[model samples]
Target: MDLESFLLGAVYYYGLFIGLSNFEFDWNTGRVFTSKRSTLYAIGTDSCISVLYIYYWTGNANIVDAIFGKANLLHEYIVVIMTGLRITTGLFTLIHRWYQRCKMMDLTAKVVRMYMARPQVKRMSRWGILIKFISGSVTDGLQMAIILNTMGRVEPQFFLGLGLQYWISVILNMAMVQQYMIMLFVRTQFQLLNSELRQVMEETKEVQLNRRHQGVFMTRCCSLADQLEDIARIQDELQTIVNQLEKVFAIRAAMIYGGYYLSSVGTSYLAYSILKHGYENMNMTLSTVILVFCWCFFYYLDGLLNLYGMLHVQDDYREMMQILGERTLFVGLDVRLDEAFENLNLQLIRNPLEIKVVELYDVTRRSTLAMIGNLITHSIFLIQYDMEHF
Candidate 1:
């Protein structure tokens, strides 16, 4: 009814909209990683805080009415119910996040197993898993703290302070996550190059065994080595991107936390000023309404700022995933069969010079034909094999 209460309601509903919108957008975009569960917790806690504000204001109104003999119990009861719902919502969010974390861990384990099969690229996979675990744990801890504080009836100032701390922690953790991902990508590139190098070395061994093949083998090895070197160069560029991300996160964290503290202090001072000077003209209802609006406005601003940070973090994560997805090698049957046949031919060709060239050629041609037929048959076998495994 008053302007302040109306604004408080607007702020609360607006925050609800923003929070829900973010949840829906992230879910659709597939950016909901393990850390996102914590975000849902945060949104729930914020909604609870808003409800608490409403309850506090409504109670204050009832107290004023009792003293002045003006009835406002209906409003007070409505707000109390809202408070209860908010608390329940917060509890549900906590449980949801806990369940999601467990599921995420299970998925992560599966991913690690898949990565280990890479053998050459296992180190990068391990690093990625480690970083994700650390980041997820820290985020979940922070969210838990917020849930406890809300349920335990913490003072508003202390709650805001803790929220700011969590924000800083989240930003830093995200930065570390990004850095780890870049390192993982670098490691993957190295693994690929290492595998290429091993192949080149095997070719070099063939050249060593037969001095006549030295020039051709050396040229191919050199070309492959050059490609590996180029990959290294690209990794260096990726490292530079990681460095830039670190700097951006550091600066952004400082600004965000700094702004949060400054805003809190400013809001507190503003409330104090209004309470001290406006008492003569303002009724208790008006004062309570003003306080509610102030709290809600501060929360709204904090949510917006956090949303910005999350968007940045999510953008980087999506970019990294996109890159990784693109790099996934699609080992076609044709390619694999060609490689297998080539290896087989190379091994068979290393025979004694007493073998006639014509006989060797005939053997090579026949072997090639046999290999082609076998590959087609085996390709069909693999389809059945995969179906059975699935």
Candidate 2:
């Protein structure tokens, strides 16, 4: 199957598993198929699942675990808070998907068309997807198995609850992967567009070099105008896709980033505790610590991959803007060509296609570094507090 088919198929099946959707997508065409009855049923099921999930976790572990419990390890509280944040983020993502399903479908269609137009550049292979799937499955499965085995005599109800939790986590993780792929696809289109523009600019300069006949020069200028108009139209569509992507993904991205921060702080604390005090001091075994850190390594790696993917989008947009700036506007070119260039430049300025988190800030290198700085600061403060108090 093609990349789009594989990606959408995974989303459709995973959505069904999580009650995120009941819609079907064509394997070849990327068309969404759904009916009122199915959508209503899916919504009802999703609501029930949400209610059940919240209820299960609420009674399973309360906030008191962090504050009043006898086992007040520094990471115990962090784990509790991480669980809450992850569940909240998952719920938000599910609801957001339902709310923005139409736009997602539209965006998918546009992206699929772009893929079809340039199949040669579709470099993603099925093996890449399979490897990712296997790696995540193995890591999370091992972690869950370790937890269950450590508990001793896991009941069916508890196992099912954990299973549901696993499903939610997997879906949320896949959502990040999907968002990264979307950005990758957009970046590819931008590259193609920039290449085309560069070629046109070269041709324009070549025509300028050999401008012996007035008729030939005028004809070439008109052709340049048409090419600019076409590129501008494509650029406009890409901008729309980028906007819709932000609308569909911004809140989820913010939530995921919050989840990442929590996970990082929590896991870092756990690793620190294990290292500083030893697992025996915390009533944990070496194996448990090893497994926890192993799982966390993969999880953090996934988050970093998505974060870097967002950074690449910003990088590519900058490159495109530079390419546009290099365009030497030929004198006496059609007025329409000047207008197209002006319009394109204005759009780029106004609606820069940078991956943003809820319209608050662009995910640039500086912002990411600042976030890491804050994470380190918070972690150090927590470690010091634990040293003095606990």
The local distance difference test score of each candidate is: 0.39, 0.71
- Per-candidate TM equals 0.31, 0.85
Candidate 1 deviates by what RMSD?
24.5
Worst 10 residues of 1 by lDDT: 352-361
lDDT for each residue of candidate 2 in 1-390, tens digit (9 for 90 to 100): 666456546655765655665565563575666777668877887787688887776675443332223445556767768877887888877788878888877877887776766664456434434545555556567657655654553444465455566666866777876776677667677777888888877887787688889888878778887887888787888778878888888888888888898778777777677677776766666676677777787877777766766677677778878877865556655566667767777878987776677989778899989989999998888888888987
Q: Which candidate is the best by TM-score?
A: 2
Clashes of each: 0, 0
Question: Model 1, 23: alpha-carbon shift in Å?
Answer: 16
Give the local distance difference test score of model 2: 0.71
* Alpha-carbon RMSD of each model: 24.5, 3.6
Judging by lDDT against the true structure, name the best candidate.
2
Worst 10 residues of 2 by lDDT: 62-71
Which lDDT tens digits does candidate 1 get at residues 1-390? 543234323432333332321221121132324346646655676465455544554542333233223223332343344334433443333334344444433333333343344444544345444534444444445454443434244444444433433443343333334334433544464455445544544554454455456466456545544543554344344344433433333333343333433334433433443454453332334534444454445443433334333333334333433333322232222233234334433332442111111223211335436644754564445334434542
